[model samples]
Target chain A: MESDKDNASLLGGKLSVINVGLDKFATELADHDVPVVHLDWKPPAGGDPKLAALLSKMGT
Target chain B: MDIIEKANEEAIRRMLGAEPVLINVVPAREIVPNLQDKMILHAGPPIEWDRMCGPMQGAIAGITVFEGWANDLNQAFTMAASGDIAFDANHHHDAVGPMTGMTTVSQPMLVVENKTTGNRAYCAINEGLGKVMRFGGNDAEVLNRLAWIRDVLGPAMGKALRDMGGIELKPLIARGLSMGDEMHQRNVACSGLVLRAIAAAMAKTSDDGTELSEALAFISANDQFHLNIAMAMGKAIMDPVRDIDGSSIVTAMSRNGTDFGIRVSGTGDEWFTAPVEMPEGLYFAGYTEADANPDMGDSTIVETIGLGGFAMGASPAVAGFVGAGAASEAANYTHRMSEICATENPEWTIPSMDYLGVPTGIDVRLVVDSGIAPTINTGIAHREPGIGQVGAGVVRAPMACFEQAVRRLAEKLGIS
Candidate 1:
């Protein structure tokens, strides 16, 4: 639970971001001297279209 | 504040204050001032005839036939190849359109006016899915649909709009942002809202209620019916911000099938263009990535105003179309846009952000420094002429465009 003071700090403090989808964005943010964390994300179920379809079918 | 900051603030102020009202629909030549008989307006920055991509060339050919300038496709092609017909960018004429995005003199265009700034913008009526001219369908069926939209649909819509006094689009767009429409990839809710606003007026304007109902039904079925109006509204909103001396805010982002282009407020009318990137997303059945044309359209205006891809957090359903595949990823995509924008537009709130404003006023300096280009949701036309839309997806404005604009802005500001 973040307190009011913590929330305020978060709003105006050192900027950091968790960038997914494209690594280029993360690289660019770093070039600008902005603090950022890049998380390489992929579709679930190891990106197998059929298995992911089944997982969606099971509502997971 | 510095010059850039002051200019950016002024730019954003004009954008925030815009009140787009759909006043009427009229032929492109009648409403669009100085629209000459031989001149054709297309999406994105200007390109010569030989450089235009297949879909754009195909659309020009179709428009020529529609205008009776040529009797057939071959003759139209010859006319175009010979430079008998002139081509200019839609932005140059205060107009915009979706893919292939060629607007001829006689085509009916929606006229949207910003009551706040007294600026007006025009956009062609959306021809609605499959076998449409905008997507490069130039056959008789496509031409016939254009005629119907020109003759029957345009008059009916114009009459209905006139009956209502005018339909205010800004508030409706505000409602739509909250109701799962970013007004580009998915306009289902806004389409419904427009119908609800004008359905009564539509009925009132026509004598034969059945014919009117059929037209209304056609509108009801096309979820993207409100796209042209929204685009025109964006144009109306953004036109007031152009040439604002030192503003680094992007005024336009559009693409021809071959190239993508951007214009910064401070840079006046100069365009920063780069090679277009093909969109990556699910294709319609029987279509694949190889068949996809490079992204095209003036629909990117939605993104320029902080809707389309920027408001995706509020439109979780768009995840599938843009390949996010999950609501959280869509939300993150919207959050990412804020990193490059100058400010958020409080008027257009994204519900998922706890009603935080949608990110507005894309700053070229921030974009260059951050290296994050604006994301756009778009319809993919088939690369070949006349096949129509193959799929829909997301693509980024090329980083080179932002870099180029930033360099120009820096030079203009006398900064190293």
Candidate 2:
């Protein structure tokens, strides 16, 4: 019962967020007065699985 | 650190330590080794006549006529197809050129020597804007200007350069960077600087007042006059960085109209290639994307040494001209470029980035790992021959070339 009350308190507190990959989520959060940071990210090796595997093999 | 990382550190060190100086201007045959009669050196990797793009073909024909090998463009085209004339890349001869990048035996070449390594490189004089041979203009007027450069301007500049004991390029380029020149699409500041450096020397060396006055006026009027000089400087600086055993740093990146190619330090002269991409930017009035040719030139050598687009933060004035978004966004381009490079150039720094060095020594492994290709600032030429420039813009070097380079490098090192 105490843990459940703690969870409710945590959920009600001021929110800050870190968004990665697509930035739409961060933009939406910012619109609602939430502090947010967006990280510009892309899949390694242009998202090519074979190239990514090769890169890993090369120990890059 | 690993062997690859150690080798890369050495390569970048040699590149930064290079001090390229403009020594003299002379005929191509006189300076470039093994440049034979009837041979034409062009930009990019080796390409056959049939695969040559319209602008390249046009430039070849123009050069043939300019050299008096053929009477007209039609005859020149037939001769080019007939195999009587030989063609090669400028890179094979330790030289570089812009646009179609035609370098024949008779054209005057600017000779730049790297004081650090005792290696040298060459390039042709930049023809003033409008219909010119570099962009495939082969008309009688173009031929007349070529004749003037070969007979008059070349000799005058050569004398002036020799008289002044050659100008050291490092400080000049550094000053230009601070004054809004990127040594690529925008060279106004550098051009004025070159004129200031040589004006008195040119006067002292010239016998004819009219010729000296015309030469001064010409240099002052053309904003991009310093680009060819900068190309030779880049080639001179980067040549000594080649052939390191385990280095994955890129030594060269260039494009023919059909293909874009890159050379890695570990791979020697072997080129990793992919289809070239078209540039996206603002077009001249009455022109659009359909009118533009795919990217082509050896001018990317400047970027290879971290001056052109990689230093975009230094010249916000070029941001709008190249269609690289708002001026305020220019520093972002540099910041992104930093993600893939081996190090930053301490000698050349951008003020807008709080005196941060320009990104230097492109690493093939980092490019593949991060999936960010090098951005190039370039002028758009007309797809059809002889139409000259249609626009200017920024383009991405294709990612496929970097992927291939990384694979080949890994294979060479016996990692896969």
Candidate 3:
């Protein structure tokens, strides 16, 4: 019962979030008065798996 | 740092340390090496006459007539089709030019020397605005203006530069950045600066008072007068950065009407190219997207060393002109570019970004990792030849070019 109350208190407190990949999630969270940071991330090597593997080999 | 990182650092170091100076203005035949008779040097990578887009074809015909190879445009077109004219990329001859970028033996060329490395590069003089050959307008009037530039302006400026002992471009470009000139689509500030640097010398050197006034008026009236000089400066600075082993940093980026091309430091002279993209932005009155041609020019050299769109934060006026949204959004472009570039240019900093340096030395690996291509600020020409500039705007270098470059670079370094 005490643990459940603690969980509820944690959920009720101010929330901050880090959004990766798509920025829409960050925008939505910020609209709800939440603090959020968005990272401009993309799949490496232009989403080409072979190129990504090559990039890894090159240690980029 | 690893081998690639160390090589790239060296490349950027050489690029940043370069000091390009405007040395002289002379005819293409006089200064540019291996420029043969009946040969025409054009922008972008090597392209055949049949593959050339409208503006290039139009410019070629105009230049043929200007060189007296043909009597009329129709004859010039037939000759161009007949294979009498030898065509080569300006880059092959240690030179560069703007849109259509046509340079025959007769036309005057601006020479810029990298003072530190003792290397030099060349570009043709910019014919001020509308109905000019650079935009592929060929008529009696265009030919007349070419003649005047060849006879009066070129000699006058050449004499002036020689008398004044050459203008240092680094400080001038720094001042231009502080002002609103991006040295690509917007060069108003640098144009005035060039005039200020050379006007007195031109006055003292010219024998004819009428010729001096006409040349001065032309320089003052043309807002992009310094663009060709800036291009030559870029070429001079970047040439020494080429051929550094293991460096994946892009040394050059250019576009013909049909294709865009880039050269990496590790890859040397080999060009990785893709189909060129059309620019999307605000158009002139009565012109729309329907009339715009694919982006074309050798001017992207500015971006290779970090200016133009990479320095967009410096010119909010260019932002609105190119339809890049509001003034506040300009710095965002620069910020985004920083993710793909190897480093920031300490000397060419943008004031609006708290004096943050312009992003410099494009790294192909970073571009593939981030999926952000270099943004280019450019003027849009008409789809059909002879119509001249229809608008100005921004476009991104194709991702495929960068991908191909990275793949080639990896193969070259034995990573594959």
iRMSD of all candidate structures = 20.0, 2.0, 1.9
User: Which pairs of residues collide in candidate 1?
Assistant: B136-B386
Candidate 2 per-residue lDDT, tens place, B24-135, comes to: 9999989998899999999888889999888889999999999999999999999999998999988889999998999999999999999999999999999977778888
Q: What is the DockQ of each candidate?
A: 0.02, 0.55, 0.53
CA lDDT of each candidate? Answer: 0.86, 0.90, 0.91
Candidate number of the best DockQ: 2
User: Which candidate has the top score in lDDT?
Assistant: 3
TM-score of chain A of 1: 0.52
Weakest lDDT window of 10 consecutive positions for candidate 2 chain B: B128-137
Place model 2 in a CAPRI quality band: medium
Clashes of each: 1, 0, 0
Q: How well does model 1 score by local distance difference test?
A: 0.86
Clashes of 2: 0
Tens-digit lDDT track for model 1 on B168-242?
997898899889998998999999999999889988899877778778888989999999999999999999999
